[model samples]
Target: MWQKSPNHQSLSEEEESKALKKAPSLRFRFILAGVLVIGIIASLAINLIFDYSQKLADLSYDRLLRSALLQMDENVGLIRNEVSIDIPWSAFATLAQAEEDRVFYKVESLEQGFITGYQDLNSFPPNPPVLDQIQFYDQMFSGEMVRFAWVQRYITDPETAQTVRIILGQTRLSREEMAAAVTQKAVEVVVLIALVAITLIIIGSHLVLRPLHRIERALEERVMGDLTPIDINTPKETHHLKVAINHFMARLQANLEQLENYTADAAHQLRTPLASLRALAENARDIGYSNSASPEKQHQALESIVQQCDTLSQTVTLLLNQAVVSHRLQTHRLELMDLLVPITASCREQALTALRQGVHLSLECELKESLILGDSFSIQQMMQNLIENAVRYSQQDQDAPAEVIVQVMEFDLFYRIKVIDYGEGIPESEKERVFERFYRGRYDVAGTGVGLSMVRDIVNHHSARVNILNTEPKGTTFQVDFAKHRFDGDNQ
Candidate 1:
């Protein structure tokens, strides 16, 4: 016969208690979300600023080119004559040098052809001729892309009836350079705006999140088991969440108070009945007429009284344990292995009794020695109750070989303990009620109805879980799962 090894890594009650204390609160997540939203908005604003600045630079460059074209048009008449034009280059030079020095001027007549300064410098005629006003064109000049502004003026020679079209055009390198400079300056301004926007976002986010931080600090300073409403003066944006949290805390505080009262009241009520039954049993044993009254009858009465007393005692114990488990469930660390050993030991006597009644009792432990953080005592009590219930419900008739099987296995993040009995299984309808306190099945059996309920309370205390499955071939199985615990020592 192989002795099953206990789950060594099971969390003790103390460990399960510690875990509930470490869960993060909602306010911390809220602050992180707010910061993320601000960061996204800042990024979008920076892109928009850069785009708007580029548009402004293009508009300003077009305006400057038009103004330079108008100045050349006003001076064209003074420099043009039929067949013998004496164009003073100084007038175009003055206009070119005034605003942008990278300008190149040219004068052309259909009859005279290219006949002025900068005309041989790769100049091209403007498209969509400007009859009386300036037209802007982008063209390649001297192997360099340039913007040009030009106008064509038709002048009739007063003495000769011949018409001369004077074309005046200026290369726009200076305008292009000024536009580039303006665009650079706009980029610097947009960068400064983006920096300022980011700074404002950071500062505003901090101010907005300040109230949440206050609420968080208030919650952090609170003592364990303290479910007081958080007192915080917050913006309207946060009021709904604050109110919801406060309401939940208020209800929790009330529930805890009621549970405390129930435990105290139940303990006080059950103690006197147990004491009286013990006293009556003691007196019956001391009375000297035992053989005269029939020893068997006397013994039977005494045994009945003792059994009732035990039932009462167990009830009170279960209730008190439930109270303690509930409190610890609010804050506890649990180890599954630590819980299994004691539960198995506690149920050994019960198992042996079942075996004597022709029922086989076998427990198979297959879980790895995994650690968990939880309420060990509650976990053990849960296991004890489950195993005891299985044994109690198992059929003892010799015709059918009744059996109770307990198995422990591990899955990801949970340690599973299953207690299976081959007896009259629970009906589907009664399965849910089995875990309710003081609820018993209609089957005729001696039970206080608190065992399964106590098991549930213990499982809940560690924030663990439980399930019941109706096994095939007329039997029932109870499965309890405690949260898995990792071993840090080996890694260290």
Candidate 2:
């Protein structure tokens, strides 16, 4: 017994691992797809949240500026027919609570000079506001961005009333701080949700792909020679893969069994012929050593040895031919061809051999082309075997030359090949047994009995049929029929 070295085994294992790593992983792809989807949604949400937060901050702060202006308007009164106003210091107190920001207010008469408050705070609306309506606008003042509110008041002092305008401006420090705080809080929430979604995606992908992992482990743990079908649960989507793998294993198992049987049969068939050759050689050696041996006895022993060698050679040749046919049938694919080509070639190749044996081998084809789907090599071997078998048995008598004719004809639905031999026809009871491996009906005939068996194998591989029929009066005919339209290229 031999065992593989550890280093070689480890090398092979490493190679397998490399191959698996190179393969595209479904789990990784699934997770990547999920991550991409989540990323796109998160980006859109962050952008929208930023806009919403800024709008909310502006709405909350603008109300404070408007309230301060309204309180100042109530203080303007018409005293002595002239505009008089009492400045309210409490209005500034309300605006200072939100943030440390600069406040500027201006109270003035449109027709008169400044009344009270900052004279340089000129930020105002282009048009006077409607009565009881406060207008808000933004402008750059004193090198700082400010929010301003404007309102109009008609005050009478009993001498002459003047139109009073009150304006209030505040810097934007508080509004920016509030907007940043709100946006930060929203981003934190979005980050938490994104993390949770990514976690769930990883877990779900693992759960979905668990069945495939189980299948891999099952295959990896099996013995090298195991050919049994896998018996594990799988989802509906993966069922076809399991079925195909099992089918391939079953085919491999069948081929292995066939190889074992063929080996045993070949050994059994070679044993008898090899033993006879050894015995004849020993007898020839003994005859040469005998002191009283005659020339006739010595020649007879040599002749018998030569005859056994020929038989052994024929047996080995037939066995080899059978092996080649079997191997080719498994490996070769069939193609559209004309059956008459191989038949004519076989007749031509075997013509000299047949004439030497006092048998005339001839070919007769009535049709110009008899097409069938077949492997050319196997078909040629089949024809050669059939023609040789016919010639071997066609010698009826030594006085007249025996006739063996190979005929190719196209019938209504199939192509037929007939090998006719005018010799002692097979008995009805032994016609079927004649095709069995190594089964010889007549010991006097010089053959290995494997030729007809190989012919039958080739016929079956082509999905054709073969039959042995007795010719009228005294002869045997081997007929083979091939379906004309089974694999026709024209029909396809």
Candidate 3:
């Protein structure tokens, strides 16, 4: 049960401690999920930012085209009853700042042919725009994509009413260059945001799971049997877990203390009887070889020796049973123990003892359900102790049989094993103390006081109940409730 771990075979104390500290520090899965979710969100944000930057750059470039086209609008005026136009360099200078864009302009008549400017400019479709309205569109010009702005002048000439149309177009080299610059900056910002987001996520995840490492370190640093409570300086999210760990350690400490005390008490209680037995046997030997000693004296000494021997045997047996029960309960290791096996075996072993003592022993198991969970040896010891105790304490009736009835009955959740003896029942005041280790009750019976105590320990180990109640005719009955084991049809 206490075997070392296979991995620990090659590890020093410091190395094993380090290994324990490393395992519970951080979980990779949580960190991975956090990074993944943040990456997806950052990607979406970067896409939105990139698209917005492109639109902004395009809006700025479109305004430049509009400024150049407005300059052309001023060139229109009627002269000598004919439409006149003036071309200005300032009109094209704002768009020409890029030094790579090809700017073109055209002025024509709705009723007449071309008036001035670029003669090959494509005609602007649709009706003239509303007063002071300017229309902008994209078109392929001279085998290159161009941006155009169109304006119409509705002026009544002195001789005739006429509408004039003016259109301006520019190549896209400058606008595309501006958009590329904006896109480059936007991409740099997106990359920086991704790096910052991932870094924060890693840091935050480590901080959140740091308490788990604290708990692991706390457990690792403790020496053997150091079931101390953990510190409570923990995060609010993990406060409950820390408290639960402390509570578990407290329970463990208390149980270990109990086991330690039981060992001390057993050693103290057994030493006196063993010493007396040794002395009595030596006295019996001395009397047996004495020439002047009488037969009755030697016989009395022999009887004393036998009595002391029985007491020692009973004490040692009960002590061993207590230890076994304690070990099983501590380890929580048990198997399917048939209830009928112990009930039948204990009665068989105590039958002769009971008969010689004028106590009748009987078994009445009418219940079909008898399976239970416990160490078989511990269960058997408890049964024998209860039976022998009944035989010793039962008041002998001169005219009637002083019998001990072992009855087994079934209930919804448990099986009740009642060992009833028509003896002087225990008083109400001492009922609770009867189960104390080495508690010698008011009975003058020739037996060890540990039998009932061992019985109680075994009962607790199996998580069963033992009730001491009075019989109908002023006697005692020890009724033990053993929980039925959960078994399938195959096991049965």
- The numbered model that scores best in lDDT is 2
For all candidates in order, the CA lDDT equals 0.66, 0.85, 0.80
* lDDT by residue (tens digit), candidate 3, 1-492: 134676675566668788887775445777788678877887787778678766776688778878877777777777766777787788777887768989887888876769987898875646656756888777888889887888887767668766888888888788788777777787787778778877887787788888988888888777776776786488888899989988988878877787788788788768888888889889988988899999999989989988887887887777777677777667767787778887888999999899998888999987654778877777788889899888877744444458999998888778999999877678998899899876877645666577788788788877989999998776788989988886577467
lDDT order of candidates, top first: 2, 3, 1
lDDT tens digits by residue: candidate 2, 1-492: 124699988998899899998999888899999999999999899999889887887788888877778777878887666677786777887798776889888888888869887899887686766966788888998999988888886776546778888888888888888888998999999989998999999999988888778878878788877889999999986788788889988988887887887787789878988898999999999999999999999999999999898888878877887888888898888888988788888888999999998888988887887778898778989999988888888875454349898888787789889999888889999998998987999988887777888888899999999999987667899999998955546567
**How many Å off is the CA of 263 in candidate 3?**
1.6
The most accurate candidate by TM-score is 2
CA RMSD of each candidate after superposition = 13.1, 7.5, 7.5
lDDT of 1 by residue, 1-492 (tens): 123235533544456668757877455565556556655765676566456654554455556556555554445442345444555555455555536435556666665566565757544454666566566567776665666666666755565333234433444555555556665775566567656765676577677778888888888788777776777788898898799999988878777786776666576657756786877777677653555766766777787687777777676776777667666666665544565566567568567777776667887886446567766666666766777777777863334447888888878778788889877788999999988765879536766666786677667666777888987766898987877666677458
Candidate 3 lDDT at 181 equals 77
Q: What's the lDDT of the predicted structure labeled candidate 3?
A: 0.80
Candidate 1: Cα lDDT at 189: 69
Task: Give residue 411's lDDT in candidate 3 (0 to 100).
Answer: 86
Name the TM-score of candidate 1.
0.48
Best-first order by TM-score: 2, 3, 1
Clashes of each: 31, 5, 2
What TM-score would candidate 3 get against the native? Answer: 0.65
